[model samples]
Target: MTHATHTPRPTAETWALIRDDYRSGITAPVLAERYGVPERTLRRRAALEGWRRADAPTPSLATPPAWLRPPVSREEALARDPDLAEVDAAEGGDRIGLLFDPDPRHLRLFAFRQASEAAAMDRPVQAVSWMRLAQIVDRCGDRIEADGRPLREVDHLRAAYLRRLGELLPEDMPADDA
Candidate 1:
């Protein structure tokens, strides 16, 4: 007859270490090393416990941190600043993504909506949205300008949606040579 011995589950202290380290944005292997737990075991425990990143709060939650929540409707957005709303809506319909998307076109579209929503809150500027737009422009400005398609009534206005921030800066325009 062979005798069998069972391995004990991780201690609560270990589980707490795993959860806290994971919440602090530590990698599983690094967390495992720091906490003296096996990486696979820590990962399995994390998954079993339903641990998730809290980098951004969800919008559906009530009063979800004013900075974290943008206005939910176009009417609400437009009521704050008619110009941005008009220029922004010209790009497309109202839609707020639940996450940061990398596609330039999507980012550009999201920039307009985010800025408009933020403006509706009566801020001098929507810093993050402008930063995102700048990033999109830096990433794909040449492509957008050369693609030679329009997203608004006037070809130039297609991208001039950004000009709402300024009183018609020349940089917000496409070349007239088109």
Candidate 2:
């Protein structure tokens, strides 16, 4: 069996009305009455145009949405929850590796540490290090280029990472990697 799809072609005026009255809580029946068109047709056209009722009450800026609200301080949170305080107190033993947070500073630190460890293990850190440092360079590129030239800022960061690489790796590491 072949199924045929019929798409309703709305006129300019109807489109303008659709755009204008979209979130105005005007039902299809009301729109049909006002536009002298069938309620089903208006609904079909609205569906085709991907219009939705914007009836949800917008939260006031004076009182932010819960997620956007500032979180209480770590100490305050811990004070309220004793179990959390216990966890904070017991933060160190076997969970050392578990605490490897991937935040920007930690990410770079991790790369540096990995480079150092890889060199100790007699494995080159080149393949992974370049990609990781490139990500950092790209993320901070906008801020780094404030003094005019872009390549200079990237080169400076590259030089710093390269210096760390030199410090960690054997002196025989290829110079062209710079």
Candidate 3:
């Protein structure tokens, strides 16, 4: 005769703590390690029980919470955080031009600036998105100019940029349609 080994189930109190922690934005892996439970088991339980993380947006809500709403105007935003007022004033005409301008150089510069800001904020994914936007702008060949007018030789410039992009990209990256 052979005896089967079984893992003990978590006590009600322990399970409650796990649920609370998971709902409050603690990752399943961290909670599992803290409570001596398997990460897979914790994840499965959380999924089955519909454990919504505190940081996640609730899809079922008819109207989002006030904190999720954007400020109505720049004045309202500045009122909320007075520190932004000086930056806003300094960027006034240039910021408006950045939004309205279709110039590829300006767009590329804007994308690079966004990437830098996102990187500084420790948001790698957002930074990568901005960098990709910059690359897209560069590859479009709208930056090539002759006598202050965009050059008609766009196809050649685009082909060259695409070749450069392929060289810079990792071997495993998906091929772009460009």
* Candidate achieving the largest lDDT: 3
Candidate 3: C-alpha lDDT:
0.79
The Cα local distance difference test for each model comes to 0.64, 0.63, 0.79
Clash number by candidate, in order = 0, 0, 0
TM-score against truth, every candidate: 0.26, 0.25, 0.36
Comparison by lDDT, 2 against 3, better one: 3
Which structure among the candidates has the greatest TM-score?
3
Worst 10 residues of 1 by lDDT: 94-103
Whichever of 1 and 3 has more TM-score, that candidate is 3
Candidate 1 lDDT, 1-178, residue by residue in tens: 9876665666888688779878777788888777667788887877677676456333354555554565457677577778876666654543433132234566665666667656657553675666568576768867866765444357456546666745656666876695
Candidate 3 local lDDT, 1-178, one digit each (tens): 9996777889999999999999999988899889989999998888778898899876666675444454257788699999998878866755677654447787788789889977765677889999999999798745342234433468668978999987899998777789
**TM-score-sorted candidate list, best first:** 3, 1, 2
Model 1 error, position 59 (Å): 13
